[model samples]
Target: MKFFAGAAVLLLLFALAPFASVPAGHRGVMTTFGNPSDQVLSEGIHFRVPLAQKLNLVNVSIQKGEGEGDAASRDLQTVHTRIALNYHVKPEGAVSVFRDLGNEPGERIIIPAVQEAVKAVTARFTAEELIAKRTDVRDQIIAQLRERLARHAIVVDEFSIVNFNFSKSFNDAIEAKTTAEQLKLKAERDLQRIEVEAKQRVAQARAEAESLAIQRQQVTPELIRLREMENQRMAIDKWDGKLPNVAGGAVPFINVK
Candidate 1:
């Protein structure tokens, strides 16, 4: 009789084994006889058949992944880039995602999506444009990735380009081009300064010449004779009565009436 009682107890435990708890931020997929059911289980306690049904939890929270890959620019230069992606499996599509992509959707979907998106976007811009227009390139990549992954029920929260690398020869070429441009600008500024100085000198010479011409036009012989007579009259007024000195065979002030 005790043996039968123990067997009954074992059967009861087996029946209770299917009761399970789904944690927060997770959804459970129930598979019966190795076939996934369309109905999904939300967080909290649930019950299922012990041997015939299996429950797998799928995290519906946001997850992050990183990847690096090489691509070619429009200028045929090799560009290497690192990318960071934030994504999540749609809560409503958790069961479908799990059924289609299995447990790890990021590996099969997100990583390759990131790589292809980056390559496609990078190929549209030259190396210099890629550096200058980083935001545009990143936006293009994110948009493409979002569109592609949406079909698989993956939601892309955010995407970013972490780093970009070029070959040593390409870097050296860019540096050389920048240096040449700077030198050309400096030369242009110097030429402008020299031209301004030259113009200033020519203007100063023309002004001095005009001043001398104005003086020549105003002076006359009649004005010079009037100035000499005024000086003699002033001398005569200041002299005393005695004046008998003669020089150079002529008497001074002989015509003084």
Candidate 2:
């Protein structure tokens, strides 16, 4: 009678156990006798065998991660880069994620993947190209990260390069090169302006010389004789229609030849 009563009380306790509730944005993984089952339980109240099964909740929401590391560019220049990423566990792969990475997957997996991806992509580009082709570099890194993380059932949603740092020498070289280019451009423009001004001056001198030549070509013996006759007529008109008082023969003093 004692054994029967104890067994009945145990049965009632197990039957009256509370149902497991998986929270929002989480999926439930059931483990039977310390071994996880392939079946995933959706978010809601679930029933499991008492003492034989346990329910573990895995979050599937997006998460942000940041990492920084140093690498070498293709040109052998040292580069330090900080990167950020947005990712989430694959909903269907929750079982695999739980079995493989457990909790704190970001530190265990995502950060290392980011570091590796950054190094791999940076090596393919020179320091200058890294600055110029930033979009391409980011895309390549994203691709590599996706390929690497997918095996672990981690999905990468987005990736970005937060910043890139280079050696002081490289930065100084870039600045000097930019200044030299600006100076060269200014010099070329000045030379062009000077050439244009010189040509304008030459054209003005040529025009004046041509005008003088044309005037010389128009001067002939007929024109010279016409000028002398015009001057004699002018002297006759200015006379008071009377000869000078002391003239010996009262002759007209006009050169009309």
Which candidate should be chosen as best, given lDDT against the real structure? 1
Q: What is the C-alpha local distance difference test score of each model?
A: 0.90, 0.90
Candidate 2 ranges beyond 4 A from true positions: 1-17, 224-257
Candidate 2 weakest lDDT stretch, 10 residues: 243-252
Model 2, 82-147: lDDT tens per residue?
A: 988999988788888888887567877888888888999999999999999999999999999999
lDDT string for model 1 (1-257, tens) is: 99999999989877768688899999999888889989889999888898888888999999988889999999999999988889998888888888888878988888888888999999999999999999999999988988999998889999888999999999999999999999999999999999999999999999999999998898899988998999999998987978777667766656656
**Backbone clashes (count) for model 1:** 0
Q: Estimate each model's TM-score.
A: 0.79, 0.78
